[model samples]
Each structure stands twice: as structure tokens, then as C-alpha cells.
Target: MVHVILTHEVKDFFAWKKVYEEGEPLRTKSGIKMTGVYTSVDNPNQVTLTGECASAELVYRFMSQPELKAAMQAAGVISAPDMKVLNKV
Candidate 1:
């Protein structure tokens, strides 16, 4: 399995969450098997998302899609995202 970790800052958490929910179909279609979300206790706008996928290549493709970038912009993401893909040992 492949694990994806993403961190970013959003202008509004609620708005970002709404946009995120709207992208469920795309995410599923991109081979996301499971996901978990977390927010920073010190800064609510800081968001972290972890996803499990069938392969790192699939997750990388998903992240590179133009639609995903548009979605993030529409979701009010105010900062560039940090992402990492890991393979299960």
C-alpha cells in the first residue's frame, strides 16, 4: 500500500472542508482507499491529510492533476502544500 501525507494552510477550514467533500468522487476515482484528516491544535487553519492508496504512482498522479490544483485554489488554500508519498515496508 502507498500512504500519502499532505499539509497546508487554508483561509477557512469550513470552506476547505466543503470543497474537500465535493471532491470525494475524484479522490475515489484516483484510487484512494482510505483517508484521515487532522487540524493543528495551535493553528486551526493548518490542515493535514493522510491517505492510503493502491500505489505511490497513483497518488502522485492524483496530486499532479490540474483539477486537484483548481480544487485547492477554490477551497481557499492560502499556502503551498507539502506532500509526501511512502510505501509500506
Candidate 2:
């Protein structure tokens, strides 16, 4: 199993959440096993999303989409997200 960590900021939490929820199907079809999303304790606009996927390669496929990047930018994400890939020993 692989863990994918994504950290990003949005202009509005509720609006961003709507988009995320709407995109659930695409992710489900893409082989993400499970996912958990959390908001920063001190910053409402910031979010951390952790997903358990079949493999690091699958996770990379999801993150490497041009549409995803454009959506993030259009949603007012000010900076590039920080992505961390991890594995359990």
C-alpha cells in the first residue's frame, strides 16, 4: 500500500469542498483505495488530503493530470501543492 499526502490552500473551504465531492467518482475509478481529508486546525483555507492507493504509480497518475492542476489553480490555490509519497514497512 502507498500513502499520498497532499497539502494545498483554497480561496474558500465550502466551495472547494463542493468541487472535491463532485469529483469523487473520477478518483474512485482511478484506483484510490481509500481517502481522508482534513482541514488545518489554524487555517481554514488549508487542507491536507491523505489517500491510500494501490501503488505509488497510481497515485502519481492522479496527480499528474493537467486538468487537476488547472482546476487547482482556477480554484485560487496560490501555490503549488506539496506532495509526499510514503510506504509502510
Q: Estimate each model's TM-score.
A: 0.94, 0.87
Per-residue lDDT tens digits of candidate 1, residues 21-70? Answer: 99999998998865789999999999999989988889888988999999
What candidate 2 gets wrong by more than 4 Å, as runs, is none
Model 1: CA > 4 A from native? none
Error of 1 at 88 (Å): 2.5
Residue 41 CA displacement from its true place in model 2, Å: 1.5
lDDT of 2: 0.82
lDDT of 2 by residue, 1-89 (tens): 89888899888888888877767777888887547888999999998888888889988998887877766766677657889989978
Q: Hey, what RMSD does candidate 1 come out at?
A: 1.0
Please give the lDDT score for candidate 1: 0.91
Which candidate number maximizes TM-score? 1
